[model samples]
Target: MVNIANYNDLVVGDRVIEAGNSENFQTGDWRSLIPVIDIDKCIDCFTCWIYCPDDCIIIKDDMIVGIKATHCKGCGICAKACPKKAITMTPEE
Candidate 1:
């Protein structure tokens, strides 16, 4: 993932284009926390997938499978947004 701190340095022309562009940056490595999914608790509501700023949530057959740790920035929005409370943010070791 592109360094978020450098975003402010970019000009108007330097912006992501197309869908899923964040994949190119591999930003998850920069995160200090990681999101863990409790599959048993998950209702497959997709709340985390919809709220992920980095689009790291993986979905299959309309079911929320897991998170892409390589692209996740450890933002706790997923955990907070989950109505089932299936997601939790933990500090990386």
Candidate 2:
């Protein structure tokens, strides 16, 4: 009989995450969502920028807000921070 533990991908050194390599993650699992902003209703109060834990919301000149998805963890803070309901949390396609 073959050992069950023998057939796994384990790569040590330089490639490990600082959060550490987790041994139990399946494919297609979601860790976050991306926040989308509606420019029409946004007043650019900078609430989202201040509230974002990842500092991903970039507001420019009180006119537009940009969501940096690469740096964003999508904790929905921007949605909550928006006083005008201008932000929504949507999953990446």
Candidate 3:
């Protein structure tokens, strides 16, 4: 059987004790909402990418492509930063 740590066994704070180990943790599973990008409405201004805390915005050749759902925590910062309203937060189903 797999061993899982309960709340009492977890660390006290949200600190990264080791450097260059953030990739080992995947935080997307707990998000209640997800960001959706409308490529048609995107102006390629990179506004969403600038404000995204998780770096979930995907850019290609100077164009906003999509969101990286695997690492996105649905903070809604990207949606609010989109000047063209190209990004929207939707409930995760």
TM-score of each: 0.74, 0.62, 0.77
TM-score of predicted model 2?
Answer: 0.62
Residue-wise lDDT of candidate 2 within 1-93, one digit each (tens)?
A: 965543246446435555633423332233367788998888877888888876667766665658765566667877987899999888787
- Residues 18-74, candidate 1: write the lDDT tens digits: 786655778877899888999999998787888888888899988888889888888
Enumerate residue pairs that collide in model 3.
none
Among residues 3 or more apart in sequence or in different chains, the pairs in candidate 2 whose N, CA or C atoms overlap within 3 Å are: none
Ranking by lDDT: 3, 1, 2
* Cα RMSD to the true fold for all candidates: 5.7, 6.8, 4.3
Model 2: weakest 10-residue lDDT segment is 21-30
Looking at candidate 1, the ten consecutive residues that score lowest on lDDT are 2-11
| CA-RMSD of model 2 | 6.8
Cα error, candidate 3, residue 50 (Å): 0.7
**lDDT score of residue 87 within candidate 1:** 82
